[model samples]
Target: MKKISPKELHERMQGEEKVLLLDVRVEEKYNEYHIEDSQVLCLNIPKTVIFNLEERDELAQITKEQPIVVTCTTGNSATKCADILDGLGYQVEVLEGGLTAWNEYRK
Candidate 1:
């Protein structure tokens, strides 16, 4: 999976880029604040235990060829999500350092 810094991701978002920015943090955290156009998909729950994987259906909405970037509080959760997506044959990337880095660099 490709890895990108938050600053670079922010710049891409500013431009006319068709990118899927995913925030893997919790819903409450996301409700507090998140980058523009970012979709929330928390990875705190165990993927194996969560049978209704298609609950959100965001994965189905997006094509595997699309540029998907995952982000969490500190990038670990996002990395895990990226791995799962990658294994499923999706073109995914992880935002290095995640939202923390983004907040530090951009805000």
Candidate 2:
């Protein structure tokens, strides 16, 4: 799997590039705070769902058209999710250090 830093993600958003963010965090956590921007399409699918569900319909909003960047509270869960996406033939990247790093970078 590939990896992307919070700085790089921020730069991409600033450049007006479309970003597909797959947040593997729980829905409540995602609703509280997440990467938001006009260029970003963020999906809040819990890590457990991604691990337990076989239906891709829940992930229908996301496509193989763009590279996906998965994130969680930390990098661990996102890494697992990225691996699953990679196995499923999608180009995926883990958000290095996840949202914690992102929050720090934003400061």
Candidate 3:
């Protein structure tokens, strides 16, 4: 599994990197707060458990080669999802410290 810092992600997005931000929190949490920027596209795929196949299959609609960044409240859930996606041959990176890290960085 791969990991990326929130600051680096923001820098990359600022540079116009086409990265996918996959938020694994529940719908309510995702709606509450998330990384919002024009340069990066973000999608919410709630994961009640680690690597739900249904969600994974649904995400298959997107190209596998896309730079995918997985995030959650504390970064724990994203790890599981990242591991699963990596095993499936998708290049997945976890948001270091997850949303907390992002929130702090923005502050």
Better of 2 and 3 by TM-score: 2
Q: How accurate is candidate 2 locally (lDDT)?
A: 0.88
Per-model tally of clashing residue pairs: 0, 0, 0
- Candidate 3 per-residue lDDT, tens place, 12-101, comes to 897856678999999899999888888878988876643556545567556778888999998999998888778878788999999999
Error of 1 at 80 (Å): 0.7
Candidate 2 ranges beyond 4 A from true positions: none
Candidate 2 local lDDT, 2-94, one digit each (tens) = 899999999888876688899999888999999888999898888887787565668777777679999999899999988887887788989
The window of 10 residues in a row where model 3 has the poorest summed lDDT is 48-57
Cα RMSDs of all predictions?
Answer: 4.1, 1.2, 1.6
By lDDT, rank the candidates, best first.
2, 3, 1
Cα TM-score of candidate 3:
0.90
Give the TM-scores of the predictions, in the order they appear.
0.77, 0.92, 0.90
lDDT of 1 by residue, 1-107 (tens): 68998777767766765567767676778778777654332333323322246653545666777777778788887888788878778788888998889889976
